[model samples]
Target: MQKQADRVVQILKSKGLRVTPQRFAVYANLLERLDHPTADQILNDLNQDAPTSSQATVYLSLQTLRDAGLVREVLLEQGVCRYDANVEPHHHFRCRCCGKIEDIEWDAFEGLSFRKLRAGLKVDSYEITVNGVCDRCQH
Candidate 1:
């Protein structure tokens, strides 16, 4: 967590972006939370810690972090958007029952043939989202 806090500043400076409290707080929160959280959810959590941080601040901070390539935005069902701090190449498994998003390893796709993707012109980046009920929800 401490390392991520410092990383937030380093990444911001490397991207030539000014470091602000709200932006730092937002990124720090994202780093701590492994669960992909929506902007509203993030704002709610931040309100508990820093009362001064507003929705706009959180939204703007999210945009800035995304623009700096420090985070990845996950677009889920029903126009729901979740933020992930792990920017590495990976996929997602979403729980249909509880709306939880879990990261799936990139190596998991190694054996599968991406015929459609391979035939495509060029794929810069891609993320596969699988929707199903989680174990906890299955019961």
Candidate 2:
């Protein structure tokens, strides 16, 4: 836990952000859960042990963390955003039946890049979401 805390502090300092208690709580939650939770989901889970923590606090913390590049948000669908603690490049596989998000690590694809036919086009990152029943859901 101390190592994770140190990492959080380092990230905040490197990004010129303050490492506040609320921010740490939010970040620690994301790191521990690894579930790619929505804002509401994060609030609910945090409330279990932190009843005084407000929904707005969670939102603000999430936004700050995202802005600092310590966390990443993936828009899986319309009006739905999921928070990911893993900032490293990777793909996500969503289970259509259960709405479960799974990370697919393919380092080979991380360096993949392509040129656009049109001018002034650039691709910062790549994404490939396989929408289908995952193995567990199929069984």
Candidate 3:
């Protein structure tokens, strides 16, 4: 079967965005590794093959991808920013011991009535992050 993730990249390109090698590498990295990587982590991972991706390049590429809604950013303890490739209204979990991030299945908003409470408030995004030890670190 064809992959749905590849369609995401195609949609991004059709919007007139330049698909650079570095950007493609970033997307591939995200696809391979589901862990939420900080910009530095992404740089380190990319450096394994692309030994010259400067920190600034990663930041710019992340911004471009995020702006296109292809990626989403999450903040954890101490204002640390982590990135996730799945952007379809999901929750996140962060490990306190190793700072690893994982996606958690949650649908707690099904009964919420935020619009009724605010009377005119427009809610666009939702983020939920829980911090604790991951299974690997506990071993």
lDDT top scorer:
1
Candidate 2 lDDT tens digits, 3-79 = 98898889889988888888988888898876699989888887896586788999999999998888999987789
- For model 1, residues 1-139, the per-residue Cα lDDT tens digits are 6787787789889999999988887888898898999999899998985487888899999999999888888887778888999999988898989977899998777666556665557766677888999999999
* lDDT per residue (tens digit) for residues 1-139 in model 3: 1364466568678877877777766766776778888889999999986498999989988888888777888776677787778888878888889877788776844675565656777787667777899999999
Question: Considering TM-score, where higher is better, how would the candidates rank from best to worst?
Answer: 1, 2, 3
TM-score of each: 0.88, 0.86, 0.77
**Each prediction's whole-model lDDT (CA):** 0.86, 0.85, 0.78
Models, CA RMSD each: 2.0, 2.4, 3.2
Off by over 4 Å in 2: 108-120
How many clashes in each structure?
A: 0, 0, 0
Superposed by TM-score, candidate 2 places the C-alpha of residue 107 at a distance from the truth, in angstroms, of 3.7
Number of the top TM-score candidate: 1
| TM-score, candidate number 1 | 0.88
User: What local lDDT does model 2 show for residue 139?
Assistant: 86
